[model samples]
Target: MVNNKQKDAPHAQWPEAAQTLIALMHAQGEVARLSEREQLISSLLVSVNAVLWAFNWETRQVLYVSPAYERIFGRSAGLLLADYNQWRDSIYPDDLEYAEQSLAEVLRKGAVEDREYRIIAADGQVRWLSDKCFINRQDEPGQPVIIVGIAEDITDKKHMETELQRLATTDVLTQSSNRRHFFECAHREFAEARRHGSPLAFLLLDIDDFKLINDSYGHPEGDNVLQRIAECGRGSLRRGDLFGRIGGEEFAAVFPGCAPDMAVQVAERLQQEIQRLRFNHDGQAFSITVSQGLTNLTEADESLDSLFARADAAMYEAKRQGKNRIIAA
Candidate 1:
């Protein structure tokens, strides 16, 4: 009963209205999907113990910070968000200047910057952090420059590195500096002594009858003897003294600010201490002695090697002179 024009008008408008509704729904679905994906990625970063953040360089404010900031930095996200200085104050004093300089460089170049530095947590624990930041410049006029960044807690990794370095430079048997580390330290001490014209004494020590002990009681017992000798020597030396195991049954000590007479007295006391050590292995009780050679820095000595050679020669002379005495070179 309706007019033909009127009937066609409603039908034509229906398709256009439906299409617009469908497009709106699709757009909403896409927006929701993107938000979910971003949240999932953020959760992943938190799971891996990383903090994600965005900073506004021009405004000098933190625009965004992940939840992981509370976990890693031991500071609440709300607190840091309210005041940027809360995060800045957490940085260790020594590292703050360097970090500022690095940030300045990144802003100047408008590129990525990476730095490793130390931070003090709210719990009074010192932690290491590795930070990577990328500059995001705004194309629109009057928009603030932004910095997108991530920071990771690298304290455990840093500890592992430090322990590895210690193992590399230290002797496993005596827990003293190894031969290579000994030389490295000695070279530096030698250079400084030469520059300042200071008195520096070097002493080489050898375990008396070490081979005999190894042959008599096996290597384990011989190891015990060496450890005892090292303990005695360490107890006799001062804190500033450099003592290290230079070879099997051979050790060396560097005494800075010690004269030839003081070196002789120290060597004598160390020999006495070693002689007093009583070692009991498998019901076999015995004592050991050490022979030492002493030398001092001299203008005639051109290099560490030359000085060490003279000390070695004197140590052999001690061995020749009854195997339990100290000789000066």
Candidate 2:
């Protein structure tokens, strides 16, 4: 028989060695899983179109910034993490106060959901951001006060909103104020004039023999004439004057803070300008004229409607007496 002590010693240590090997394998598996999870999170953050950030409010330090920061802000994320002032400097100067105030409001309110502002990127492009922030430790007094936020690029949305507003308020043909917008602005001006006892004038003008022109030359030529007249009105009016195309071949103007004599002079100048415009259609040349009715604010006037009525009446009188002149009511 062999030596029994030596055989028993080898047998005794095998179990311990096996246990150690098993433990090491389990630890390696756990580490691999954790690495995969971390990689997944990094990929997700890189693909997102918004910036996710975390900051230490007490220390005023940027703790973390997502990959999208570089794309949206055109700046380095490393610089931002090194100094929080990078964020402050990137904000549009006009919006800095509001941005900081709104961010600070998150501490008291626990969240700020609708903070929209502009930021100047590294390349000098102004971009709009819809940033929402929250206080992570609002209830824990002893913990570090951390602020976490997400900012989305909203420049395209802001541009779309501006375009829609322009389309709503503007005339397509003449690019002047439409009838509804004109009245809305006019009502506000009328109220302010009434409150201050300021001088204001209303003028209604219509193209003379417009039907004849349309019938003789066609609607295209008629549209051309209308566009030219609108241009003349825009060029002749004062800075504060409001002009609009209220109807076909009809335009209206409101002159705020204009005296009666000055209003007359302006109308006369517009008349001469229109009289000088010459157009050719089908190799035949023709000229156009306009009839205008003007009225000034009076102590006895009750409302803007009264002024409109007086101007309308005077405009018809001008049409009846002669075709191409202005009459004051």
Candidate 3:
């Protein structure tokens, strides 16, 4: 317990009470060390803007919730540490098992993993985040030392991914799904509807005399017609419907949960809209029209070949009828 004065001081000058006070000061040094450790942890949490969730290895219960919990998730660690479900329930339902599975895997291997999941906010808004942690394997039975992790908000990153997906699947010119992306998506919709015993329809459409327009007024004018028609058709489409360009001046529409008759009605509207389409080129007014073929696939198939074949046949039938008309098959 002696630091400096205790070793050199005379016994008469240092009474029993003075020696006792020196011992007490040595004890206070231990207290100061403890305080410094706690402050270091507090500063660490604040510096990185992180919530540290510390768990005891053997009890499998949370031992500490750093104040960063309030700063990040708008909740107190005191409440969260008392109940594990408070944090578990905040995770998105779809990601709940993922989180549990990841933890189980980590425990078995004593490894660290960086994972992400959605968190439901107090305002009922959902956000995504990622965590990084090190698995502490200190002296314990069937346990670890401490499970500490840091998390960050990735909601904006998730939104950016969604917008990028839209760009990949859509055609900038016609505002329709591109040909390759359309078939991939349509086949999925067809298979799902067929599995559920639901009805579905497909429509094949082509502008009447499209080549003549391109040959006469040029491709730009013809493109103008296609864009306008897309806008008009999209206006009448249901939220789940899809329309896409499959070839030059050729388009396909997928009608999920709709019967053949309903598809025929949709085709009729498209026909009328195209028939009435008008545009001006260099102050010379002109109009364009289209012929459409409509068909339904009652049987489920992995390939869109058969469905398109039927619609193609029906479309030729419309073309043969002098164009600017809809024929259902």
lDDT of 3 by residue, 1-329 (tens): 77576666675576887888988998899899889998997788677755666766556688877676676677667778787777887888999998777766656666655688888876788888776565676676855567766677778888999889878988878978989899998999887887898888888888888888888888999889889888877976777998998888898999999977788777777777776778888888889888888888756545568889989999999999988888888
Give the CA lDDT, 0 to 100, for residue 290 in model 2.
Answer: 93
TM-score each candidate: 0.86, 0.88, 0.65
Which regions of candidate 2 deviate over 4 angstroms? 1-23
Model 3 compared with the native: what TM-score?
0.65
* Best-matching candidate per lDDT: 2
Instruction: Give, for candidate 1, the lowest lDDT window spanning 10 residues.
Output: 105-114
lDDT per residue for candidate 2 within 87-185, as digits (tens), equals 999999999999999999998999999999999999999999999999887565689999999999999999999999999998999999999999888
Task: List the global CA lDDT of all models.
Answer: 0.88, 0.94, 0.80
Q: Which ten residues in a row have the lowest lDDT in candidate 2?
A: 135-144
Give candidate 1's error at residue 61 in angstroms: 3.2
lDDT string, candidate 1, 41-153, tens digits? 86787687788899887778898998789888889898887888987899999999987778767777775546888999989999999998888877888887888888889
